[model samples]
Target: MSTAAPLPAHRLFSPARVGAIARNTLTELTRQKVFYLLLLFGLLLIGSSVLLVRFSFQDQFQMLKDISLGAMSIFGSLLAILATAAMLPRDIEERTLYTILAKPVPRVEYVLGKFLGIAGMLACALFLMGLLFLLILFVRERGVEAEMAASLSGDAAALAAQIETLRAQVFHPNLLAAGLTIFAKTCVLAALTLFVSTFATSQIFTVFIVTTAYFIGHFQATAREYWQAMGGAAWSKAFAGFVAILFPDLQIFNLVDEIAVGVAVPLALLGKTLVLGGFYVLIYLLAAQLVFAQKEL
Candidate 1:
């Protein structure tokens, strides 16, 4: 009897197979009601941006920016939590993974597909909300400028100067940077959730673990503070370094304060954040594929 040697490991990462898996995964997600709910929630959060302006006492531009950014963060996080948890296990529970696994589809392909599917959903959510936020901010900024011009009886030059300053604040580059940072952060969270779901027995477990990670990821700055306060003790420093390696350094993507106040972020830093997030996402998916390949469905 001749024995067939196992296929090589490098074949698992083939782009063609990964692309096919991604397409199928995307199609499946589009057919679900959960996708619609997520879309609706995103829209609702965006629409509330306008309403939040009324409470700002005509500081509507800043208010609009705040609400819009906040909405993106909240909605993105929730979508990541819910969508990833339901994707894989639902298929496994229905024994659908068996059908897919029986074919030429590799475990790595399946995991990559799952991650990209959720990433696609996150991308859509971000674009939709980000566009709406931009439009609302533009309108609010213009309206506020008009109001300021009408109320001020100063010289034309002074009035123009005031409007320009306000414009600088409202249409700040940092605000745009902040929004993009949040979008990037959401992608990282989505990838993390998908990675966790690859091995989790239940959606609850995925949710619990991802949420904990999210909290810890957000606490990167706090963790640094603790390490500094500990006087650089070896164990404390080691623990902090371990955390830095294990969890996504989410603080890199937090530009909320800068956005709200219009602080400039270096282009280098922005590029670094994207690269860091992409690296983590790739590592996570690879790790997930390793575990999932041995899982008995």
Candidate 2:
């Protein structure tokens, strides 16, 4: 029998090779109807913010902010989990992974490709919802400002001038903080889903595990405290410590309330949290690569 040709190791890990995988995964994701369904649901939730604003008699701006921020978080989290889980299993079930693996592409490149593709979709969802949020906030703020101006007893001209000034102050950096915080929070959640997708064998299991992890990751500190209160119980403490190391500290990225209340924490603190999130993403992706490498097609 003729000798099989040795695969070119350098070409297998090249950036171009990885990018092609990412592109293919992205195309596959876009073609799936589940993505469009979620997008429609997300848009519907975002559109409902106008109705939410109408119900708030006191500080309608706060109401709008709450709904908009919440919609982004919920939809983004779902999209991240859904996309990451489905992509891997779809390839495997179709027997397409075998063909791809037979090429010069490494399994690690495949994982990274899937991760980045899902991430790109999440980023798009965030941007779309983020724009919707800004528009709703703008419209609500304008309506409130106009009402206040019309209620003014003095000249209309002076009232209009005052309203313009108020609008400027309303959309200032402090007010914009909520939007920024929500985006950061989405990144953390998306990274988490990506990490979990690496090990999960089935799409349903991946979604379930990632969703549970998302909820518990934020409360791990509370678990630690509970363990401490148990009087140094070995099993409890061990479980808490295991959780602490396994999950990313999600509370660091949760600044929605602080932003809503206009509290100014140091920007440096946010920067540090973002850096930690990045570290988690890298570590989890690396772990996923290691796992995927050993997994048989």
Candidate 3:
């Protein structure tokens, strides 16, 4: 029988190696046809926004804007939780994890690579969906502008100013910033999902736990405040506080409403979101590596 050659004395955590795994993971996920949700998202936005605009009688662009951003947040959350949660569990279940780990690859690299892949896939989905959303808003803005230009029989300057204001409100940069906040939220959630996948009993368990975590995190602030406001006993207050401290504060990313209405999201807030999200992701990845290292095949 032929003997296998030993691994070369090289860094196991090279970007090239990690990137190869990441690319493969991304390709695997794309083949699963998750990107097709873009079509469903587009259809929902188009169909609902049109009906909403017809019934509301005004502010068509804002209606579309609100709905599109809200949908993006929902889609991003679904992707972050489901994609990362399923990756490691599926590989382990199919014995693919053994095949990879039996080679020269380190467990840490596997964790990081899988995370990068999920994050890359998520970024692509968010961008495309956001683009389609913007395109819809663009068309709506043009139609609204044209209608106003034609309908107004008085001051041309005033009409032009109104259209300009409409343009600003419709194509606001704050919306894009809001999308970044959404992406940041996705990153932290994805990392948490990855951490869970390393130790959960099954893929289904991982998904369920992380999904529940996200919902809890989303309402963490409100729950904490309610419990603190004399509606509960000391133990309940302690439990609520513990839950709030356990999950990343997702309320910080609740910028969709503010951005949808043209309110500026402070630069400082965006910066803090990125920093905190990144910190949580790093912590989760490190924890995953430690747990995975001790995990039996």
Candidate 4:
């Protein structure tokens, strides 16, 4: 029997090779079945919206917006961190890393492909979850209009304006923007987690550190201000500056919270967030490649 010819040695870094690794990585993550959490959240969303109706209708809708968007942010971050953090160590434990690296693949391609796969999976999860959120919010919007529209007894013009406000608030473009922001944040977390996994001996260690970093990122601005306030000594100031430069400024992405409440974000700011995230992803992947390449398999 004849065997197929091998790919040219120089093409090892090509997209085709990189994409193959990514495809396998995606399949591996999918088999882990963590994505079932998305369905569970969808059910929670419906139940929560229904229960929220017994409380203030106006407040309930806003709460719905918060819960839905916030859930996506929380879930996406957890998936990105846990999934990417575990991947490298697990591959090593299973001896799969040696098998892949023993082939024609470059270390950079392997690192980059793994990140792409994790990111693609994150994007898919966010999009599906976001769509489900929009559907639930639409249903809540219609129910609110049906029950509250007539009950909104006021000056005719004022009542009409209030109704329009509710409608506009529920179906705003801000929801999609919030979804995109969550996905971008997930990419950043995945890259950072992958970088940590390169040297981490255990998955628990990687997860704990990444989770802590994520929490700190939320208050990066406040921490910076406080550090500046503590300018009594040069050593203290230098230490604070070093930390600030090392960790990402994650507070900047918290605009999703405001956007969920119907506050509009400028397109320029959103574009900047995506670009910043892209840079982090690029830098982390390169660093991961460098570290993993030198690691004893």
lDDT (Cα, tens digit) per residue for candidate 4, span 1-297:
999998655864689878988998999999998799898879889889878877887788889889988889889998999999889988998899889989878888889889989988998888889889888888877877776657766567877787798887668877777887888888999999999999888899999999988987777678778878876578877776777788887777767779977888789988998888899888888888889889888
- Name the runs in model 1 displaced over 4 angstroms: 1-14, 34-58, 145-166, 230-241
Off by over 4 Å in 4: 1-9, 148-164
User: 192-292 in candidate 1: lDDT tens per residue?
Assistant: 88778877889999999999998888897798788888788798888888887788878777777656755678889888887887887788777787878
Each candidate's number of clashing pairs is 0, 0, 0, 0
Candidate 4 TM-score to native:
0.90
**lDDT against the true structure, each candidate:** 0.76, 0.70, 0.85, 0.85
Query: Per-residue CA lDDT of candidate 2, range 117-190, in tens?
Result: 76676666676676666776677677777777668857888787877776664465654455555555665665
Please list all clashing residue pairs in model 3, or write none if there are none.
none
Candidate 1: which pairs clash?
none
Candidates sorted by TM-score, descending order?
3, 4, 2, 1
TM-score of 3: 0.92
Q: What is the TM-score of each candidate against the true structure?
A: 0.80, 0.83, 0.92, 0.90
* CA RMSD of all predictions: 5.5, 4.4, 3.1, 3.0
